[model samples]
Target chain A: MLKATIDAEIFREAIEAISALVPECRLHTAEDGITTRAVDTANVAMIAFTLKKEAFDTFKATKSEIGVDISKMKNIFNMGGKGDLISLELADNAQKMAVSVHGYHYSITLLDTNTIRKDPNSPTINLPGKVVISGEDLNNAIKAAAVISDKIAMGINPKDQTFYMVAEGDTDHIQREFGKDELKSLSPVEARSLFSLDYLRDMGKVMSKATEVEVCLGIDHPVRFSFDIAGGNGHVEYLLAPRIEAD
Target chain B: MLKATIDAEIFREAIEAISALVPECRLHTAEDGITTRAVDTANVAMIAFTLKKEAFDTFKATKSEIGVDISKMKNIFNMGGKGDLISLELADNAQKMAVSVHGYHYSITLLDTNTIRKDPNSPTINLPGKVVISGEDLNNAIKAAAVISDKIAMGINPKDQTFYMVAEGDTDHIQREFGKDELKSLSPVEARSLFSLDYLRDMGKVMSKATEVEVCLGIDHPVRFSFDIAGGNGHVEYLLAPRIEAD
Candidate 1:
């Protein structure tokens, strides 16, 4: 078993930034240490990794150690990177587990040690409205609206065959329009949703790594996206809460 | 004059990533409301940016409309994407300049626009050491050292005829060694220097954009590097201060 603690900001900065540039990462664990697996097919590619036992001492003060799923740990550790070394410990029977990064430790006591559910069932979401569009275009549209407003209000009117992302502030207001079929597949049921620009921007981290994303929309409902990732093994789903309209 | 208030992050993220990817942007001032420029060719590419006066309300807000050097603005806008919409204003006399990004508006009073140096000055240090290696290797080395320490200390001794990069923390330390005459030239004069890992990492940004780089090392002095960038006018010179260490 292996356990370690590291600078949370350093971990996030490296994982988030680099993961955005590549696909899924394979984490390797052994009796002596832990290793990360990533390949750069691109000519300009490189990966630097290192981990020590002392680094994990902060988190695993008394507990001996545990192996970790770098992928899940990466997401769980995204809370602004300010914590002592993350700690990991495996149960004596080696059938269950616990992991923590930057003081945000979570106990997954129910997980089966031998089976890592690659496609765990993500929360089932039935969005009232939907659309299909280029990730690039959608990313750009979000960026444009985000310039002036902290949150973007997206509305799709199937009858009108239009999709809109709007943001308004006291001194600035922006409305970006993308044709119904410009880059997305849209359903007629009209729906509107609002989400923080910050979260959406963070979402951009995964856009390029994954080719296509499906966005589910509803009035004041949380936005859900299903990523058709390159790898056939893992199932990752993201859900974001929407900001309620004052009116 | 073009002025607009864009989201600090949206603008910064796109510009920073793109600039790091491309070298020497060709900024064309639209004579009749159209301008185009091409940067880096293969990995990362950017095309014409079309913003009509209607789209650019700030253009409608001012009378001074002139094309300015984008490269300069790109350099000064180094605080990262937090600098929201950048303000491009032509001086009343058309010589000075002003830039507002990320809430910080800087007024750059130029001594002489024509005399101001646009090119990075090449230092004449008669560098005692030279190395030709994979940009990836160097980037990785710096990254590893950066993890433990703020600055990387490098030692070059003729007696040992070796090059070393070391990072030492209170309890953590790392060392990377390169063979003598790693590249093209190696002189007898022994020298050692320490420089900020952050700045070196910034220079490393060009690594992915270029294949091979020539590194020049001086004793207790600034380090210089030149990259044979691909695509457009690809060249950059980065100078960094040496960290003093008392033995």
Candidate 2:
């Protein structure tokens, strides 16, 4: 059994973060909070999100796992106005969830977990390069790179003490660098990786709303983005594998 | 020879009005103003637009005909910001037009007039039923009808002195009525016609910005929508042929 009431904006932010990588997820709910860890179908990206009890106006639940359709949740949230409160309730062993927002009630049938991929274990790796920057600045770099190329390379310049993003087109290229003065903080460890713009474009949109995001990088390794939501009560992390660079 | 400088917003509005119906047009320029009349490729809808000299900050032109690619003009206008001044210059008998906006200069090759459709003559038909209403309201009705059916019926009830729009779906229907209070004015002549929503949906979007739109109707005849642009200095009329109602 679970019952929760959350600010509409906060709930939308959480659902949008998860929907960026996967259409469905197996959400685990407990007395303390709710969490989900899922990988995209292509295995190139994974998203892990946690919303603590503090994120909600009221929360109560027993330890349980339920299948959620992230896309359906996005649709329902689209009907809500800013500052609206959303209430959700699910009875023990029930197949349907009740959602109420803005005077509208919706009964959504939960997807069967048996048909979804099992949650994958988070990989263990060390990324020596770390940088904390404003989410708007990071998203701006992603958008600028997308205008010129389908792939972007991100790395740290230890000598310059700056984080740099570069996208090379057949005849044109764009490069942007963020120095210590521009970033909240930076660890200038040598790191470089190429990533597909398709994934970053969608991820950038969701990250744009965040105040600050921590980006971790390593040579030819996955890139990880971590940020806080719901005024620090919730957390979201995105891990995206690098694309092999072509000679 | 022609030289003109106009507000970017006014220019964008004119281009958008023409682009909604046709990709290319034979534009007529005179000392008084500029005008264009053309039908869509499908020949089901026609657009006639006029922008008076009063709409421009500076205007000088003689009687001339120029073929314009509406799509290309739209792309150039995309670079302009609100209230920006745009300048256009063309030499007599020249096939290229120079357009400058926001410090950027673009030389566009004009389409050959011989390749474009000849100006269509405005049909001589009396539409006894007329109603003047807010453009936003009209656009809203068109959008609401599109949700239920591919066609919508618009008519005036002489007895009730009301204008009504209706769309009937296989399982449902929607009706919206505008009375004297809601409309600026009404002729209250009994008239009804079924029109394809495809054309109206596109035209409605452009019309929505106008403060007032005049809708003229007739039984089994085409519908004509007239509105002012450029703060009353310019005018646009859209005539859409009716679709035969299936029994």
Candidate 3:
């Protein structure tokens, strides 16, 4: 038996959005494991999820710790019957997890919850430069690029006081500019990066709830965007692999 | 110069959603004398699309018109550029439309606009019964069924006060019952029908923004769902052919 308290709607929405793109079902037992992978037919994307084990209750050691189908589990979670608290009970001899959300209860059996190995080769570059901007601005930028190109090139030049996104295709091109006034603050440096449009779109889908987004970037490096929600304790950090374009 | 104002966003959204599904590029003009098409994929998905009369937008006043690529037109319309008011001006001696949305202006050359005739057939027969419901509820029910089955059976019985959605597949089966409590009202008789889940999903997508929806039904007959949005001034209706069940 397990019980946890969380910002119900946000958590459910985030999980639902991520599960739509992720295909695998691997739940890490560690509280700080952070990133998880759920793969599907089209492409595999990483979901960086953070939940303090303290958010849960009734501490008891269980012999069996398992992963559940992320998609189905997310669907059941989103049905939301319990309210602020979510309760999970695993039948003693069965593979099903009795999940209760708000007041509604659903019993969903596990469809194979094997643990997925982490991508060790994934870059761990420390990003020092950051900027804060409106979520709407960034969301629109990503969405616009999504139409013309599959990769978005982001450039921030503090000295020049400009932020730009350029999406170029063989036939059409789109460029958007955001000035220094729109930025919360800028760390001085000329840094640019690129990332896949699909991942950016996925991140934008969930992060649309945030009014302000903190974006950290470095040239030829992974980009991290953090969304502060649920009074700051609840946070979602998205790390996207940069696409290096040859000059 | 070309400019048009559509009063409601719901209409634009519905038209975009429906048009995205159909591959045909050209549409008959309001007078049916001129046929027009936009070459942008995004604009095709959006309403209030405008293009300069060019080799592409050229339609047969008494001659055959060019056929434009639909996919591209849909993109520009979806960009939702600043303007609720749209204006389009032709570039003299050039095959380009200077499009304006709000203050945002962009010049786009036409690819090819073909005047194609559309054969739209509305379902015949007066449905014997009707049900009124919130579009949100219906969309959710169909979405749930879509996850489990490709085809769903919808049965309405006013006599017994029941509306049922049943979907059966090799591995999964779902039957959802919406009684009088869930529905605003139901006028029923001896009427039941089956339809493709794809079509239902599309219909639901088209009516996603609607607050209240009216569903007209008849046994073994086409189903019609009408959305009354923004105080009934806005109307969107979808008629779908029925799938006769073996039993």
Best by lDDT: 2
**What lDDT is reached at residue A227 by model 1?**
52
What is candidate 3's lDDT per residue for B73-100, written digit by digit as tens? 5665565643265443443333554544
Among all candidates shown, the one with the greatest TM-score: 2
Per-chain TM-score, chain A, candidate 1: 0.53
Candidate 1, TM-score vs. the true structure? 0.40
Q: TM-scores of the first chain across all predictions?
A: 0.53, 0.98, 0.77
Which regions of candidate 2 deviate over 4 angstroms?
Answer: A1-247
- Total backbone collisions for each predicted model: 19, 0, 42
**Candidate 1 at B12: error in angstroms?**
30
Cα lDDT for residue B52, model 3?
17
DockQ for each model: 0.02, 0.03, 0.10
Residue B164's lDDT within candidate 3 is 78
Q: TM-scores for chain B, in order?
A: 0.52, 0.98, 0.69
Off by over 4 Å in 3: A5-7, A17-21, A29-45, A53-65, A81-84, A90-96, A102-104, A107-115, A119-122, A244-247, B1-71, B79-107, B112-247
lDDT of 2 by residue, A1-247 (tens): 8999999999999999999999999999999999999999999999989999999999999999999989867854654569899898999988888777644445667888888899999999899999999999999999999999999999998889999999998889999999899999999799999999999999999999999999999999999999998999999999999999995
Q: How do the candidates rank by TM-score, highest first?
A: 2, 3, 1
Residue A32 of model 1, lDDT score: 37
